[model samples]
Target: MRNGLSTFWDGRGFDLLLVGIPLAFLIAISGSALVYNVVMSFQEVGMFTLGSFVRPFAGLKNYAEVLSDPQTWPILGNTAIFVVGSLSGQFIVGFALALFFGLKFPGSTYLRGLFLVSWVMPGLVTGALWSWLLAGDFGVVNFFLRSLGIINENIFWRSDPAFALWSVVIANIWFGTSFNMILLSVGLASIPEDLYEAASLDGANVFQRFFTITLPMMRSTIGALLSLGLIFTLQQFDLFAALTDGGPNNASNVAQYWAWQLSFREYDFARGATVSVMMIIVVIAAALFYVRSTRHEVRG
Candidate 1:
């Protein structure tokens, strides 16, 4: 026992032990939940059966039913649109801000810090604020667009099928940009300054240096960022609840929200769990990629 204690203190086993503890805890809590959810997806789960685990087994009927639903495809498509739009906007805008702040002008740090206000704000609060801002009548967005001659009339951003999804997309982008910026900023900081100096000495312009030096160095960080962003975007529910509620004939409904509606609103717990299982399956790939990216990151 004394030798085991000494070995733990002296050997790398201690590091393994530290890692294993949290992993065990995660499997105990999250793992149990996931296993139960999968079981519920296969078995029949309802309000009355919620107290027991010995519910009727339905096999793949729940999965088949969920997949066969007409709303399934459209909601999944909206989810795809939301994920793509939000990530694209957030990363592009965030990368631009990261590059701008990388220049290190006076007060740049303070200014960059201020941008985190968006990150700190609650998602529902952001959604409510955007709901007002994107309102068709008397909205600042419509007024500005009209003033700038960008639009001839007010847009029913939330209610209109054409713009409903995009409204949530826009809000999500603004909500997540700060987080993206912070991660990209750290990635930027980690890059060797000497590489840029050398590139500058070699007559490389700002654009040239960024493409060759900045991007190559940031590949790992970008991978990790995209993976995490995918997970977050898939799990997103609050903003949809606050802003669109999958309105205008399910035009803006996504898998997460739809699953919730089935589970809680419609009391189709088995189908809901099936939808959730699919989401988890989709996200697991991204999570694995993020882990792999971190493992393969270059260290100086």
Candidate 2:
């Protein structure tokens, strides 16, 4: 018995144990929860049936109902706008910041570190801060616009239907831009200085080097960043909850917050689960793309 135990500890059993524990935990916890959610999406889940795994089979009725809702497409459109606007603003600002810091001037490292305050702050806190910043009457944003003569009167960013969605988008961009900048900075640092020197010697201009060398070399990094950004933006809920609450006539409503409202607020569990299932499909596609991009990078 002693020898057998010793062999197990010293041999393949150790490796199996290391791998199996996490696998078992994942299957028992995350996997089970995911499976339960998916199953609930196809079942008639309600307050009474919520505790039980077995319920009346709904087939696709829940999905059909969710899709048939009048506000569904508009909410989805808002989500699309939020996601695209946030990602574009975050990426452009982040990449530009990354390039600026790459110059390695005085206090550049410290300045870059300061930008990480946004990344470390809790989402709710960030949302609250931005909410104050975007207030109509006494907000700094409106003050700046007024000072610049951009508008005649204060714009209600959170309450106005026209700007409610964009208010959250701006907050999201600020919240996430730091993360994007950090990742992009890492990618930029991994690039060889020799390449830039060679390109300069060959008479390549700044834009030429960026387009030819920087972009191609950073393809995998960009792909991974965008995929991760998609998942994160889809999951974003705190900003919406704090800043708008999908309010002012559901103007800023998004899929994630809408799913929550359907589930907990309205007590419509099955339809909420259906919406979640749809989002899960999108996240899965993004994950697959991230994996493929990293694999291609490894091969190259």
Candidate 3:
């Protein structure tokens, strides 16, 4: 018994133990939950059956019903807009800030570090802060717009249907921009300085060198960043909960928030699970893309 124990510790058993622990944890926790959720999506789950593992088999009825609902398409549209708007705004602003900081100006590092304050804050907190800022009556956003002569009156950002979705989009941009900046900064830093020097010697202008060298080199990083952005944006529920709650007549409604509303608020668990399953599919695709991009970057 003592020899066996010693062999187990000294041999491949230790390596297997390390790998097996996390694998077991993943299977026990995340894998089981995901499987249960997927199964629930295909079953008829009600208040009465919520606690039970066995429920009436629903087949594809949940998916069919969720798809047929009028709100589904519009909410999905809103989600697309949110994802695109947030990702675009975050990437553009982040890339610009990264380039600016890459110049290595004095205090640039300190200033860059300061921007991480937004990324470090909780999503709900950021949403609440934005809620105050976007208030129609006494919000700072309205005040600033009025000061800039950009508008004649307060915009009612959170309540008005026309702008409610966009209000969240703006806040999301601010919340995620710093993360994008930090990652993009790392990408920029990874680039070889010799390429830039050689390009300069070849009489390439700033724009030429940027287009030919910087962009090509950062392609993998951008792909990974965008994929991660897709995943994060899809999972963004806190901001919606805090700011809009999918309210103002569901104008700002997205899949994640709608799923919660259906399951918890409306007590339609099957439909909610259906929405979640759909989102899980999308998220899995994005995760795959992120993995592929990372692999390509590592190989490069």
Clashes of each: 0, 0, 0
Estimate the overall C-alpha local distance difference test score of candidate 2: 0.95
RMSD from true fold, candidate 1: 1.8
Sorting all predicted structures by lDDT, with the top scorer first, yields 2, 3, 1
Per-residue lDDT for 82-178 in model 3, tens only? 9999999999999999999999999999999999999999999999999999999999999999999999988999999999999999999999999
Span of ten consecutive residues with least summed lDDT in model 2: 7-16
Once model 3 is optimally superposed onto the true structure by TM-score, how far is the C-alpha of residue 61 displaced, in angstroms? Answer: 0.4
List CA RMSD, all candidates.
1.8, 2.4, 2.4
Give one digit per residue, the lDDT tens place, for model 2 in 61-92: 99899899999999999989999999999999
Please provide, for model 1 over 170-224, each residue's C-alpha lDDT reduced to its tens digit, 9 standing for 90 to 100.
9999989999999999999998889989999999998999899999999999999
Once model 2 is optimally superposed onto the true structure by TM-score, how far is the C-alpha of residue 150 displaced, in angstroms?
Answer: 1.2
Model 1, total clashes: 0
TM-score of 2: 0.94
TM-scores of the candidates in the order shown: 0.94, 0.94, 0.95
Clashing pairs in 2: none
> Which candidate do you rate higher for lDDT, 1 or 3?
3
Positional deviation of residue 28's Cα in model 3 after best superposition, in angstroms: 1.0
